[model samples]
Target: EKSIILLPRQNLEICSRRSSRPLPDPRPASLPPSSRPVERRRPPSSPPHLRSIRPSTRPRPPPRKSRRRKNSATFRRSPFSVPRYRPFRACPRTTSRRCTRNGDSREKSSEIFTPSCVIDFVFRWGAFVLTSRLAPSPPVPRQGMPGLGRGAKGTVYVVTDPSEMLKVLHNEGTHPTGAIQYQWPTKRWLKDVRSHLGGGDAPGEDHGFWGDGPKWKRMRTFLQTDLLTPRIAKGYLPGMIRAAEYASKGAPAYAEPGRFHIFSSRASFDMFSSVMFGEFSRMANPGPETSERDRMFCDHALDAAEYLFPMMSNPRELFWSAVGVRTEMYDSFSNGWKNAREIAMEKSYAFMDRASEDRLEGDFQRRSYLANALRRQAEGDAVTREELAEMGFLILSASLDTTSALVNWLVLHLALSPSTQRTLRKELTAAMRDRGAETLVPEMYQQVRTLPYLHAVLRESHRCTPAIPINVIKKNKASALEIHGETIPQNSSILLDSYSVGWDPEFVPQPERFRPERWMDDAVEGRKGTLRQVLDHKMYQKPFSQGARQCPASRVANFEVLTMISQLVLDWDIALSEESEKSVRSFQDVPYYQGTTVQPVMPGFSFTARS
Candidate 1:
């Protein structure tokens, strides 16, 4: 079989999971040679504020170091630690073939990978069993469906043609927008207690998903009311800056030899926690009650998250079909739920109380999203206290995972494509200079808002490897998505698979390659008119989402990513991990086949600070 096949690879003409491929190289346009050619040493100039710091003002305790050590879990080192993997709450967007957890995967999953989900009243659906597991590209598209092809996700998908995809998103297909039908899970599978992954919730209480579709809908509304505003996002900048700083110059513990990373999976997780939750996390630097609380909460949350997301078409059906059991993963899930409930409840109530008290006392701040949520709740919008909590919870969970996922890819790009990295650094440096500064602190914040190169990097990173492989999934309930001329059916979930469109040659010339400049100007080296037009036109719909259901915190996410990159570029000269960067063998578990939150899957690279 040919090494590469068209996306959404079904059982036909597919290769085995053991197959390996190379990692993606950064596009030529984004990183200019002039930028990468030169090298800089000496740490990036420290924040002027840090340099001016004086000795500690707090009085030190007398040397009473004789205290005996207690159980380590007694105090946590950080505030934001949560169980990293949750089950059904959020599905992995990009799934790959099975292998040892080492993440070495064949780079074959396509743009619209769909898990094979079929329930005849009840049964657990294995996400695997794709075309790679079966035959070849020799299977052509079915006549009526046009563009419908098979791959990992499902045997038959909607349209494979990029043009048709856009039409669907714009409501143009005969199938119409919102025409897809979603399915309910099976009863037999649900009857099996082993399949249930319950979490840390009070016995018999409705923890969130233990209810109905209306609950989710209201929670969705609550999220819309509070999180999407610009005000809240602006307040979160400090978190991104802090995380970026740590990444560029890591803690003393992990900064070792040739492949040490200032920023790793941990950094990304921590950064997001700090920004979204304020200072309440226990993972910041554990060793207290907060630490223990944070750990238990995160772990439990992940456990619960696991069973929350199953590709059964209808999540509600699955929950009701299966009785909550106490299996190992279920126990973990239950604990996670308990923790998530506690945290979300605490934060949600606090937000509501604060916002309410402020308003009642005639001391409310200016208009903002939180106020909107409050208003919705007041107007009987079903924006319950728990629902509000879920909103904050989603921000923490979604933003962090997606952002970190993208960062992972960015690091891989830098390591494999030094030239591209250098070029980006130059553009960034020029932007900094234009701001009349050589330092890496306060002023840089302002610089990020205006830098074209910085924006280019952010956009290009997304263009090449969307932080979340799956675009927003919108379920059309009332009716089908009626497009330009056609009418899609009701109850259909329409997904604008940005991955497919991003790789489409028409929208993006040489779709597979990375090209930041393509977004800035027309394709220079034998390509199309311009990538920006495609992006701006919302080609095949945006990965970040659009309209009412778009990502509320996009602005903040963008700022955080840009700031992190700016600081990283300013602070260090980085390259891919020596082992993983080798061109001969491709990276294992690259973006193409990851399930849900699929992102860059490479190791840390070598780095040295710029003086």
Candidate 2:
């Protein structure tokens, strides 16, 4: 027989046969009262094995009182919610690594403070401090800090004070070297490109623009004696004048109403080709076939210059090549050099043929730079065909872009300043009147140099718009030198910031204004007073650089610029077009800075023939 049993307050029932042993309780004592198992009646239809395991059917007990206090808002708040508290105290110098509250040490503080984390924090903050110290500052500093600043490459001592700059340049010792070490990359890339294109073997050594030491000395001497001398530079004036006239004639047809760089480049090409090759390119009026060839050749040369300059300035770009990784920059330079080599070779061979024929005539040819070089070669000079080609390439590259840039700036400046234009035109008119010639003859072009105002305008323009803003880097060859009581380390790269010197208010008052009169001498008390101009060449105005490594073509470049400006101003009434005028005004408040040079952004103008 089976019997049902109910324990007091337990609400549980158990059924067992008289002979069967009772089962032990399955529920543990730790369960709360509400969760404790309760007895329930088993349904008759349930299986026999499940009847003893039926779920408790007793009603749940009432919920016991909550242990937490009865604050409805606080009870519902998140356990991890941040509490309102006062700001932490400032870190003490003695115990900055530890955080304390009420002078009690907190657990897990050691985990938050670790050596690696401290080191990481230090490194990150240290880099920020160092970068702030080394970054380039504005031309005029807000803090009135010293002119000395640090660059990524090296120390840059900007000497805006004219007197200080004069002292530094004047004391630049013999065998002075510049900071521009582009020759290495240029030579390497040129060789690689030439080899890839099967354009003869690599150059034997760096010479001309690429060389230093005795080889550079010899080349410099040869250039100074043969082509760059004032006498030789004067001889090229007629050619320059004719080139200018040719350019002026074609300007209206080729130049769009406002755009003029293309016209300036063609004019520069014509002049440089005639003077350097003794052959006229007539680039301004080329045949259709020749026109396309000229365009391609010029594009290559320009592309080479654009890429090579930035690459040489940054050493990281060339580091890839050191690791045997060829880059697009390298490839671009290679193609450019290859094309330049072809152009140089063609011109060199033509010059050689002319020289050989001229030698048979028993009369020396010294009319053009090429003829002068060939004369030196015929006279048993040490210059070789290879050197001639190299020199030819250098001259071609240097002359074309630099002269074109100068002409562009000069024309733009003159166009904007109507009063300055009137003054310049009056000077030219007076010069022509003195010569008693209505037309500008070759002699009149030469006489224009004597005009004080014309030369002043050129000087001011050069000061305002230096083609190369930073003069080529200079290095001390022998030992450390002292300038302004500062010792520059030996073999250290020296950079003269020509832009700062040009714009310094101490030397050039009202520097932002275009005032050519500052360069003119005043006749005081029947004698020429101290000219307001910086009289010493070393004192100011190093547009073509100065000292031992000064540019050899300085005189030639000056003549080209002067002749072109005079011709254009005398014959044409020029002004900035409406669009260009608006562009200039936008940037007028701040000084203009462009790539590797200081130039205005707007490059367009309108020209009308003077009645």
Candidate 3:
């Protein structure tokens, strides 16, 4: 629910003074609240990203005269899951080598983590670990740690106190930090897991986006000097609109509507892939020639995800160099990279290969940003072939899941609130009429930033059910600092409590409510309670991210999501599936799922043409 911004200097100073020692042993979940005041400290480096959360020095205001609510009501913890991994679609966009039950084990783990946990954790943690005991047979459990609730088998716990989750990355906070059993570091994770970071592995100098020191400075320099600016991102608008049209119908039917499970995901995949590739291939029905290529790219990404799922639960020594299985998970992981590289080089390199010789724009000034990226690399921008491979894979993986989730949620939310849908449609109607846009063609396109209602819908959907429902890791330079009186040792991991942020009542009035109006008011509701996730919402930052390292593709993604939903809103009416309606009525229910994006699980809806 939250990305990061800079924490104030006072807050950092407090964090700096408190962590001179290792953290204490884990505390009971029901441990009594701390009585001491939270002091401030200086963290290891310059101020870094923080939730757009406004800090309060005074005691929070009491509930209104209408009624008071219990704190417990506000802090309903989101359910927990088993193992977590950086999704295969992450920056590296490949499965972790430890995706089987043959990876590292903790003293506490015996049985492998549950598949539900495996699925959930993989979405949240970016990586999860397990032992051989995870096989169908029962195994062992860790000492002193009693299972918390149902589904507590041999899972691992990363302590997160919301406020100090980043401290864990530094090993200065609670719990212990572990390794990314399926690490793609190409080497072990070299950047300080606890230090504020830039993507060192990002194929250039370390400091790419957010500023830290030299490494981060270089990153900022390169991106700013090259195509990373907002203007350049806006250049993709034509392609974005083209992608939406293609999803509607064109080349090979993208995730045929009747295919159910693959529908939403394939559509978004097409959209994102088009963005990365600089053109939309008609997704009507893959011709034999392109079908294999599509699978090699998208399918490889998902298959890579599935293949690693079970094997990762098995502990490491178990894989044992015995079967001659190397520490690297060549079977599941390597294939994705291998397949992705071949296809990307074939398709994208062809683009690059051709663009490099074009007369007009020297590739760098070409309309296609990717072509420009190749040109930059050629002109000493510091990117390598390996980085480009991951960049393409990341394009598929990251864009696929998020756009799919956003579209599905948009429709679901629209279906449930006819009035809201009506309001939204009115806006789209006027915009379309005013723009006089013709047949939403493949190449004819425009921007949508001025669409206020559209922005609200996307923000509200993100707030209610964030695509990522849990932690985001941050590593900083120097040593770790303390936060909220807890000592965050260097080299540890921290869990950013997004679930808590979304539900914090003090920040959003009627925290459980889904009102977009809170953001419309200018002054952010006048205080701490005013912050919300709505675009105009005082607390609203780009849901894509906040601060320096905010996602580079956010602008393009925003246009794609808005345009896709706008087209649908103007063209179709989404009605709830009877089953989905029934489940929405019940608190304990699951919906559809598109691969790992965890959607309405089986959400059913009928789309009717609307005038």
Among all candidates shown, the one with the greatest TM-score: 2
lDDT of 3 at 421: 80
TM-score (C-alpha, index-matched) for candidate 2: 0.67
Q: Which prediction has more favorable TM-score, 1 or 2?
A: 2
lDDT tens digits by residue: candidate 2, 112-170: 11111111111111110000011122221111011112333234343333444444555
List candidate 3 segments past 4 Å from native.
1-228, 249-261, 284-291, 307-330, 357-366, 385-390, 436-449, 504-514, 522-550, 578-588, 592-600
TM-score of 1: 0.57
Q: In model 1, what lDDT does residue 182 have?
A: 20
Q: Give the per-residue lDDT digits (tens) of candidate 3, residues 500-545.
A: 3333333444433455555443434444452332223222333453
Locate the minimum summed-lDDT window of 10 residues in model 3: 85-94
Between candidates 2 and 3, the one scoring higher on lDDT is 2
Error of 3 at 55 (Å): 48
* Candidate number with greatest lDDT: 2
Q: Which of the two candidates, 2 or 3, achieves a greater TM-score against the reference? A: 2
Task: Please list the C-alpha lDDT of all candidates, in the order they appear.
Answer: 0.40, 0.50, 0.42
**Per-model root-mean-square deviation over C-alphas:** 16.5, 29.1, 17.1
